[model samples]
Target chain A: MKTLVIVAHPQLADSGTQQFLKTSLQNFSTVTWHVLAPDVDVAAEQALLRRHDRIIFQFPLYWYSAPALLKHWEDEVLTRNFVYGAQHELAHKELGIVVTTGDAKREFVAGGKEDYTMSELLRPYQALAHKAQMSYLPPLPIFQFAYLTDAQKQALLVTYQQYITNSDFTSFHGQELWFEGQLKAKIDQTKGTSKQQLTQILTAVQDNREQLEELRWTLSLIKDNEDE
Target chain B: MKTLVIVAHPQLADSGTQQFLKTSLQNFSTVTWHVLAPDVDVAAEQALLRRHDRIIFQFPLYWYSAPALLKHWEDEVLTRNFVYGAQHELAHKELGIVVTTGDAKREFVAGGKEDYTMSELLRPYQALAHKAQMSYLPPLPIFQFAYLTDAQKQALLVTYQQYITNSDFTSFHGQELWFEGQLKAKIDQTKGTSKQQLTQILTAVQDNREQLEELRWTLSLIKDNEDE
Candidate 1:
């Protein structure tokens, strides 16, 4: 599915987290990066939104919401007639949020310092998705990006890539397929022994995925037999 | 307490509900109506916020949240340093929301068309209040102002007045005291038989209040004895 990542940050140039995310998506032609401007062109935005199957509002959390720029775009572009009106151009599309926060994830709980979960903080967007008849994706929260180690950052990159491009991001089998596809593409460009090692890794991934699928099928049959 | 009603409507003059609310607060010298401009003066706005004991963000609900203008004001005016820095000016102050929606209040529920409660939808503001160390008041949602009958409007006027002016806005005793104070003032301004009738009504109100207070005292004594 085609994805639109609508970046809404005032200091876009200054944000290292945004820059890292932008660079990671460079290889995927399926992903389109649309950085929001303060001045909104309602028709153009609506058209862009219409073109994409998955619409992601990516921004650093400001006062537990999107920066005003994105809110302005929503206010101006997602007009009543264009959203939930009889036409309902955005119906059945996916609405996803990618929020970056300076606070640690643990601090966003009932008794935590923030005193609310990311889920609670993001209800407005869920409500928005409900009103427009769009499927709301679970939010991808990148918490304390600056504090993450190199290994953690690498993991985050992979998760972010899947969040943006993978249609079945929630499924483990789909993730394996996505990883396999990426490795296969990388192996194609490589020459020599490294390519052979990459191919070995790809084979293992494919073998594991097949075995898992077989196990899943057998498990489903067993469950059905038990029900009978 | 001094209350600043920060009106944040893109089309303020056009809203009959807003106009009605504005008229209701015309007599209260303690209430200040500060309509937000698109161009927010951060320093000046912060100063205004500092001056008020109660800061209210009043607007029509857009996309199940406050309008973009109010969100914009929040993004800019409420600076990190000013709000939560060394000296937190907003602490112990009250943060109030006066949201107007075109939808019926019933529609904002789990099984309703909207599929979320107003409290769930307005959590962003509550989070903001938490961050600012402000006391978050229960929101005053004015749903479908155009559909309200004359008596409903009058009742709304009284409630709105209490929301802005009455210190004990949440308690029945506070409401009684507020009404008594208003009636006594009205009685002093009247003349002749009307004055006598108004004085009688005020006396009845005063007597009822005393009786209630005595009853409360007796009930508390009974509870204390039961505890012993």
Candidate 2:
């Protein structure tokens, strides 16, 4: 599916985390990266939205929401007749948010200093999605990007790729199947030991899926016994 | 107390509710009305905040939060060192939100289509206030402004006046005292019959305060009795 990542930061070029995240998506030919400018072409933006199957708004959490630039873009680009009313040009398209926060993920909870979850704070976007009849995906929150280790960054890169490209990243079974399919595709293209390694990884993924199904069945049986 | 109302609506001139609200505040000499422009003066904006005891960010709710212009004002005007850190210019000042929503008040709650309370959605502003060490006042949300009856609009004018001008508008006892004080001052400035009418209203206000105090005392006694 075609993916659009709209990055809205005042100083995006200066931001290391945002730069890294942008660079990680270089390999995805289907992903289009759009950065906000002071003066935006409204028609061009609308056209971009129309083309993308999945629309991701990526920005640092400024005052618990998007920057003014993004907000302005929304107000200007998403006009009533075209985006909302009878026409509803954006219906059935997927909407996602990739928010980077300066605070730790733990701080965004009911009893924490922030005093609310990211989901609660980001409800406006979800409401927007609902209004447009679009599928609102769960937000991918990258917390304390500056403090993350190299390994954590690598893990985040993989997750970010999945979030932007993979339609069913939220489901474990779906994600495993997607990864296994990737390995299966690579097995025929690779040479020598690399092909063998790809086959081995695909076999392991299939075996793990079977084990997970068994575990789920056992848990369901236990629940049934308790119900009796 | 000097009150500053920062109005941030892109189409403020066209909005009937906002225009009426603006007209209502003409009597308050201490209340400075600042309408945000496309290009804002950062230093002058900071100076206005310095002059005002209470700062109210007034705007129509766009995407469940302040409009882009207001967000831009915050992003540009409220900066490090000036608003926070060592200098902390905004500390001890009261921060208020005056938001007008097109949706009905009932729609903004748990299990409703909106799926979140106004307070929950506006937490980002509250958190911003916390960060700046500013006292965050309860937000004044004008719901379904277009659908409000004339009588409801009149009541809203009174409440809005109190919110902007009265230092302790949120407190019942404080509001009573303020109303009583206003009547007392008006009595001095009026003709014989008008003076008499003001005196009578002041007496009623004082009597109500006494009645409220008695009710609170009786309720506390019941609680104490239950504890025993």
Candidate 3:
């Protein structure tokens, strides 16, 4: 699926998180990155949005929200008759937010220092998506980016790519399926033992995914029976 | 208390609600109204915020959020050493939002057309207030301005004034006190049965306020006892 990443950091050149994400996302040929600048052409931005299947609003959280330019882009680009209203252009398309924060992830909980969950604070975007008749994806929140180790950063890069490209990637089961598919595609090009190991790993992942799905179904049945 | 209202509507000139609010708020000598313009001076805006005892961010809700210029104001004016950081300048000051919406008030309830309460959707501003150590006042949501009757518009004008000026206007007792005070001031200027009628109305309002407070206290006591 074609994905669009609209980056909206005022000081993108100076931000380490923006730099990391930019470099990480550059490998995907189906992904297009648009930076929010002062002289952005509204028509071109709307056209770009129409062309993409999944649109990710990537920004650093400023005062528990996105920076100014993103808001500006929303105001200018998402016009009434064009993007919203009776004849909607962005219907069924996915809208996601990838936010980086200076504070720790633990700080974004009910009784934490922030006093509200990230989901609660980011409800406006969800509401916006609802209004536009788009599918609202769960936001990807990266906290304390400056303190992330090399391994953690590399893992985040892979996760970020999955967030953009993977269609059914809202669950661990879906992620495992993607990983298994990736291994299967490469297994044909490998040697005897390597191919065998890859096949074994894929089988293990599939078994784990089935177990998770079964457990989830059992839990839902229990909940339903209790309600009845 | 001196109030500083920072108005941030992109098309303020065309907005009827904004115009009504502007005209209504003009009568208050202690209130200063500042409209956000394109080339806003950062230092001046910060200084303005510092001078006021109560700060109200007034705007029409654009895409379930504030207009872009308000976000720009926050980004530029609220600096590290000034608005936030160790020596935060905005601490203990009242930060209120006076937002106008195109949707109906009933639409902003659980299971309603909007599918979320106004308080839930406007959590970002609350979080911003928490981060700045400012007193987060309950937001005033004026909905469906175009559909409001003349009397409704007049009531909203009085409510808008109270939101900006009254320190404890959220409670019924505070509103009754304000109404009583206003009536008391006008009593000496009148004579005969007109004065008596006003006196009777004030007494009735005060009595209702007292009864409401007592009922609230009783309900809390019952809840506390049940918890015990």
Indicate which candidate wins on DockQ. 1
What tier of docking accuracy does candidate 2 attain?
medium
Cα error, candidate 3, residue B4 (Å): 0.7
- Give one digit per residue, the lDDT tens place, for model 2 in A86-157: 689899999999999888888898778676789888888988888788999999999999999999999999
lDDT of 1 by residue, B107-139 (tens): 999989899999999999998899889999999
The DockQ of predicted model 3 stands at 0.64
- The prediction achieving the highest lDDT against the true structure is 1
DockQ of 1: 0.86
Supply candidate 1's per-residue lDDT for B12: 91
Would you estimate the TM-scores of all the predictions?
Answer: 0.97, 0.90, 0.84
Candidate 1 to truth, TM: 0.97
If candidate 2 were superposed on the true structure by all CA atoms, what would the RMSD be?
Answer: 2.8
TM-score for the B chain of model 1: 0.97
Off by over 4 Å in 2: A185-189, A207-228, B200-228
Q: Write the per-residue lDDT of candidate 3 for residues B1-228, one digit (tens) a residue.
A: 889999999898999988888888775678999999977798788888888989999999887889889998888888878866767888999999999988999989877778788899889999888878899999999999999999999999889878987777998778778777667867867889998998888889778888988999999999999999
Which residue ranges in model 3 land beyond 4 Å of their true spot?
Answer: A180-228, B180-228
Q: Which structure is stronger by TM-score: 1 or 2?
A: 1
lDDT, candidates in the order shown: 0.93, 0.88, 0.87
Interface RMSD of each: 0.8, 1.8, 0.9
